[model samples]
Target chain A: MLLQIIVNGILKGGLYALMALGMSLIWGVMDIINIAHGAFIMLGAYCTYWLFNLWGVDPFISLFLSIIFMFIIGYGIQRYLINLVIRATIFITLILAFGIEIFINNLALVMWTADVRKVQVPYGASNFSIGCVTIPYVRLGAFFIALVIALVFYFVLNKTRTGRSIRATAQDLDAARLVGVDVAKTYALTFGMGVGAAGAAGTLWAVLFPINPMMGGILTLKSFVVVIIGGLGTMFGPIIGGLTLGVAEALGSNWFGTTYENFISFTILVLVLIFLPKGILGKSE
Target chain B: MAQRGATTKKLILGILIIAGIAIPFFSGNFIIRFFTNTLMFAVLASAWNIIGGYTGYASFGNVVFLGIGAYVSAVLMEKGGVPFWLAFPASGFGAAIFAVLIGLPVLRLKGHYFAIATLGVAEAMKALVDNLEITEGNSGIYLPMMNLSVKAQYIFFYFMMMGVLTLTLVVTYIMLKKKLGYGLIAIREDEEAANSLGVNATLFKVTSFALSGFFSGLAGSLYAFQQGFIKPESVFDVGVTVKMIVMAVFGGIGSLLGPLLGALSIEVISEILTNYFLVAHTLFFGAIVILAIVFTPKGIMDIISGRKKFGINYLLQNIRDHRV
Candidate 1:
């Protein structure tokens, strides 16, 4: 039973890691907390749901479509709206993200209503057992996809020219601008890419669980916990943070009931903020 | 010229106060109730101003204090048979105590970390309240209905909320006018400099936090009594915190009159929008928030006070100043 719980937690953590990576990237690079990160995730899930439900397109296939669509929207938002406040106090940017979240959430509610949705493939419920462990295909597929995406993201950041420019902009805005990097365009691109990751995660999420407009609020909070735990800026931070939170939440829910599960992450967040502001893997100041 | 300008400012303020005081008598029940609700939020936003505006800590969890106040008062009245008058102030004290206990560690965090930590604490408190038996868990506690006419009851609660608003404004005014107020703003401007100048940052922060808590608690108590229902979710709702912050930011952070104006305007607009837009009102509200933040980052108070010019040029200037 313990082994199964751990397995479930690890599987659950993978999706969380995927979600956190986007938020962490945006925060690490832009120094702005995108409070609307989960709203973008919600939008991606909706995209996947519509493509699957209407056209019978598989969620995995629709993932690319969702990412492309979300990238455009994300890019536009940053270019037109968020860019206006990026250079102000961090508080202004935070609140700007909040306004965008409120906008998207309410718009979703108006368009889609508050109904819950899920993507059900033929083998959604099918599971395989091996040596006293059971693995669901959806969960497994989602985990590996998340892992691959994180790996690819890390590699692109380290190896690619665009990645180098992003890193440069994140490090020093003036220096990057002096080098003809077009800091505004880079910020918008970074935001778009970060949100594209959210879209990908959301596509997988829709396959595994229910989706709704209100789902973003809790997901956003959970993503924050994951990012804070894993440490911001570092490549593997979300994976570590997500897994830690997943296991802690799983154990906490099992022992104290599901109502207390939320407390575990929040408690960890407070403790981390107070005791280890840099996080386990974050750089020391 | 300076003396005449000060006299005119004071005269306008005096007239505004008198008009506000006499409003309840002239207004009907619906308007009074609406005004009361706005006043309650004004108190909350004012409390937020003490820490968020003056001291530069953007707390996203002041609702926790509101929740604490509501639960404390409701429990006292329901279980201990305390009167509403006693329970109200008791709630404020309860929230203040909780703030002191948590503020010691939380105040040490700066910027976004501090904001998120307070948010975590608020959520944790809500979860804790959801589990505890004394608070009756999620089923919530209902107060005994007051034996008074409905109109009388509305009038009474209106006065109660008005009194709370007055207390908040007076406290905020004193905090800003006194040396302690300067210390708060000094810390906001540069905490390191404030510390170098021998301003005890930690104590002042905690004190401001507790003061913020006290008003939130008082507002919560009044809210519970006005509604006669106390749910952990309703009292500790994140929406309340969002509204307070939005109003404070909308009006003008770090100003005494800012929260009051912000609260009144937003509340009135929302009330009117609810009648027309129904479900879409919040969407429009969100859009307005974005536009407001983008165009008037400093706030409407700046324009009203002549610190910022009112025109397309002002908006363009704000965009230019803040854009990448």
Candidate 2:
């Protein structure tokens, strides 16, 4: 039972980490809460769904094209629209993000009409048994891809100049600008990068779960929980937070029934907020 | 003299009150419903402003109060068999009581922490109501709306709404004149300084949150009873609470009249737009949100008061202030 739970948690944690990675990147670098993040994820899911249904593209291969598509969309949006009120208070950012969420959701509604869409691969039901526990192929594939993305993210953030610029911007915007950094382009790039991460997560989610316009809100909240739990702004935060929450949720559901599963992340968020806001792995020094 | 300020306030109040009393008789039922929704929102915005505007504490998750009020009143009347007259107030109080109780712990966190905690609570409420069997989970229990007349319920709620709005406005006005309201404004402007000045910061903030929670809960109950059914999606909606905050900000955040005006104007504008062009309604709202923030950061109230006149030059000034 424990092994099965661990397997289930790791798979779910992969997607959570994928979603939270974008959130962490954007939030850590740009200091923008990016409330419309979930919508971007939703958009990614749709792109994959249609690409699969229409063009017979597998979810994994479709990810590259979806990432590019969402990247451009996110870049255009941030540069043209979000940058307009980037100077306002945190409250205004919150409001504008909400407005964007509404607009995106409505746009999705117009296109897809709120139908729950999914990527129906031939191997959705296929799995392998190891010892006494069974593991699903899709879940395993997702977990593998998640590890790849995490490693790539670690490489880019640490080894690359643009990634360093993003990190510098997150740490101190004025200092980065003083050193002749083009903060606007960096901000846009970071946002696009965030959206690209969502696209990756979306493809994975579309295969494992279903898609809808409303999925963004919960995903956003979950991302926050993951980021908060794993400690904010750290590249590896999502991996730790996601695994902890996924496993905790699994245990909670198994014991408290599926109904209580919904409250698990929220409860963790509140407890973290109240008791240890910096999170378990939060850096004090 | 304070007399002059009082008189100006009184005259404005007189005109608004007179208009409110006369509007129902003058308008058709459709118009009445629209105004009823606008006024109800006004009450909500006013309630939200007490916490968000005065205290600088943004609550992105207040919709559950309405849901609770709705469900409490709804379940009681629908299942426990209470009458509307008894049910609605009970529902409102149910939320109010919960707010005070929860506010005890959650309100201790400062700034964004409080906001995030409130959001967590709202999300939890959504999960709870959707999952709990006693609330019938997601199936949604039907209120006994067929037995009552819609217009009649509308009028009763309108009056009730007016009464609540008046109460909120009056209380806010009185508090603004006293140390408590002054302390709240000071806190919003600069909490550190306010604390230095010996303001009972914690007491006043908690009080304001409870007050805001109470009226919003009342409004929520009324909203539910009028709608004839309750659902978790609508009740625990972050969007609705955020809309109230926007309305308050758009009209003016710190003033009594700002929230009322913001709610009415935004709702009316969105309704008209949606009525004419349903597809572009959200687009228009989004545009307004962006424009309102970019241009009138202090809200339309300030624009009307000549604090910052809206024009090309004002736009330039805003860019100067906000551009990174």
| Residue-level lDDT tens digits of model 2 in B48-122 | 998888888887777767778888887888888888878877876788788877777787776556777888888
Q: How far off is residue A204 in model 2, in Å?
A: 1.2
Which pairs of residues have clashing backbones in candidate 2? none
lDDT of 1 at B279: 94
* CAPRI quality level assigned to candidate 1 from its DockQ score: high
Q: Give the count of colliding residue pairs in each prediction.
A: 0, 0
Quote model 1's iRMS.
0.8
lDDT (10s digit) by residue, model 1, range B1-324:
445545645775687688778888898889889888999899999999999999999998999999999999989999999999899999999999999999999999988888888989998888889888999999999987899998888889888888888898898888888888999999999999999999999999999999999999999999998889899989998878888988988888888888888898889888888899999999988888898889888876776676445799998898999999
Query: Which digits, one per residue and each the tens of the lDDT, describe model 2 over residues A112-138?
Result: 887787789998999999997899999
> What is the alpha-carbon lDDT for the whole of candidate 1?
0.89
Assess the local accuracy of residue B249 in candidate 2 as a C-alpha lDDT between 0 and 100: 84
- Residue ranges of candidate 2 with Cα displaced over 4 Å: B1-15, B78-89, B144-150
lDDT of each: 0.89, 0.82
